[model samples]
Target: MADYVIKTNQLSKIYSKNKVVNSVNMHVERGKIYGLLGKNGAGKTTTMCMLLNLTYPSSGEIFLFGKNPKKHSDEIYSKIGSIIETPGFYENLTAYENLKIISKIRGDFDPYTINSVLKMVNLDQHGSKQFKDFSLGMKQRLGIAAAIMHSPELLILDEPINGLDPFGIKEIRDLLKRLSREFGITILISSHILSEIENIADVIGFMDDGVLIEEISKEDLHDRLNKFVEFEVSDIDLALNIFKVLELKENEDFTVSGSTIYLYTHLSLRDKFNALFVNAGIDVGKVNLCEENLEEFFTRFVSNN
Candidate 1:
């Protein structure tokens, strides 16, 4: 329990007989980024709300830093900062000003931290920009800056990057990674985007239909991915037919996408397959051994169950 910053035991949340979160035992290691991943309405936000005490669990216990939150709400919550969806800031307030107000409200106003957090979120350059004028990505960064201004040991954010552009997503991703690595701030962030979480989280907890189906480390998930050999050739049909003649099945043994055909069977036969393609007068452009992506894994995982 001491090792985990946030630990849950059978945490369940039911609303009008529907279990939004059911018997989820989540473990968030100290100083690690834990990504709670699920599709919309998979009870991800509900689980986070339970952890923040925004809502109560139906029949489970929550432990933060090995202490019961119910017993030490003030002592526990003071060390945590969170953004549930979008956090509010004064529309006319500058990035620095909004955090100044937050710092004062939290009664830990340190002038140095105001600038430091802004710089960390890349908002220092836009220090004078009003919250209303900031771009969506900048707004998100400001929200993060406000969350961390007090230097909370743990930060919980729910779907923080749900509506950002590619550049915005990368901005927030790098910021979170920096917070975890440089500042040692433990983060519990939730998102429906598997690819984003796969990029940022140290550990991932997969949920569906209100149940936590799997919890695995990022490295372990990669190791468990299904391996396939992808080939790019001058002729797609000829290459595919070669496998077809050998009685290999589409999807089952291989799948063709665009100009490439992937082989799931005979994983070690890449060289042989390449030789066969070359002998068949097919120009082999390139070949790669790719693993099943997080999305592919999630789809297959849910389909199997």
Candidate 2:
């Protein structure tokens, strides 16, 4: 198996006067959840469409399982499944019957596969319920069941948690983790829900205005934003002088935001800085070590880009 289950090199797509996807490069490692995040109309969906061969790229190359997706779409896609936009189903058909039709199309009539996937997605009890009667969450789960029914090596979901309740979202989140960790399936999921993706994604790729800006592991984000003590002081000059005396300013490890300063060091210097402030007749009321969240980290890339 290839180290990267999906790879796109300098992919480009143009529409009339606008460039929908501009030379975006993506790498999805095997058996990992790689989240594609961006603002609305950031070309996230277009990029996925190109990868799945739903739309052809105007330029560049794409490979799935080390085979060209354009030339060998049917052969390569046999091992891949995707649910983009919305899950399509016959509203009148029951969940079981709907999945049964999909199974027939895949040429796999194994009733056990259908039942197993249904149970895995928590839709087993809704077997006789018509698709129209299923809730939004149940419908989403049923869509996932259809996607993985054939046991594809790769699963692509676009906004899997869209319009889902908190409980529903948590359920799907756990399911995706189970798919990656237990079944060893690589998932390429796109969503504007940064926090939810943060919980499940092993790797994250940020896309903006039709281009990929950065791709980093979840640990990399924590390591980058970690070890910074942010504080709000009444006197900015006094704080600067104290940091300078401590040789922290010499290393450019200090950042000022209005009346706040992020001491890019360790929390061990909490008492040291506090004492310096008191001796200097400066009052320090609130000092907090900022805990990094996915949204905060994601903002850095989006704004900078």
Candidate 3:
């Protein structure tokens, strides 16, 4: 069996009469980046909270590092770090001062440790600046630095780049990659931004309306993204008939939805297919050879269920 840093079975949560999070089975391997993605209110945060024991699960089990967290909360927390929503600090405190307080609160740290985490996050030079004077991205870095002060084995972050500019997003992305590559820290991060997740995640799990829909590795996702030809016709049934006469296999070669037919094979024959449709009195509203990109693929995947 693979060594999993975090695992859940039938994990669920209910608020009042509404089920906010349904039975969810999640697997996050050790020393890998796992991106949990969904729209706001998809219960991504709820699930993470349950894993951290901030919120109790209504059903199911959670295992962190192959042991029940409930049985070892002290041992579990010592090795896990997290930032949910915005990380807070005294506005007037300098970056070093804020982290110093965090270190003091934790009751364990050498003076050298503060600078190490800050340097790892690229905030080492900004020590003199107060938290209020720092940029959004800088604040995030400090949050991360605080989370990593003890050098935990696992880091859970929720929307770390939500409002960051492109440059800031890139900064955080690079930092996370470095942590995963250099330190071998397993990370479970949640975000609604599809492009950022695609750029950094080794594996992705998508949730919709509190249900975890699917989880796939980045390689499998790329393999499944096929370039195809899209045909918008006046009639889907007639288009299917024309496809049959042309000896095109159903599903294997083409799929129909409403007035649209997508051909996954023989993409080079788009012109010939258009001619055949026109010859059969089928109104070809538009025929364009199209390729599915990541955004479109994600939308189609999550919305289908």
The CA lDDT of each predicted structure is 0.91, 0.87, 0.91
- Highest TM-score scorer: 1
Q: Give the per-residue lDDT digits (tens) of candidate 3, residues 33-53.
A: 999989999999999999888
Runs in model 3 with CA error above 4 Å? 229-264, 268-290
**For model 1, how does the per-residue alpha-carbon lDDT over 138-195 read when each residue is reduced to its tens digit?**
9998888888877899999999998999999999999999999999999999998999
Q: Which regions of candidate 1 deviate over 4 angstroms?
A: 232-251, 256-260
TM-score ranking, best first: 1, 2, 3
Candidate 2: where are CA atoms >4 Å away?
230-268, 276-287
Which pairs of residues collide in model 3? none
Assess every candidate by TM-score.
Answer: 0.92, 0.86, 0.84
- List clashing residue pairs in candidate 1: none
Q: What lDDT score goes with residue 235 in model 2?
A: 92
Instruction: TM-score for candidate 3, please give it.
Output: 0.84
Span of 10 residues, lowest total lDDT, candidate 3: 287-296
**Model 2, span 178-260: residue lDDT tens:** 99999999999999999998888998898889989989898887787646677778898878887877778534687888788
How far residue 295's Cα lies from its native spot in candidate 2, in Å, is: 1.6
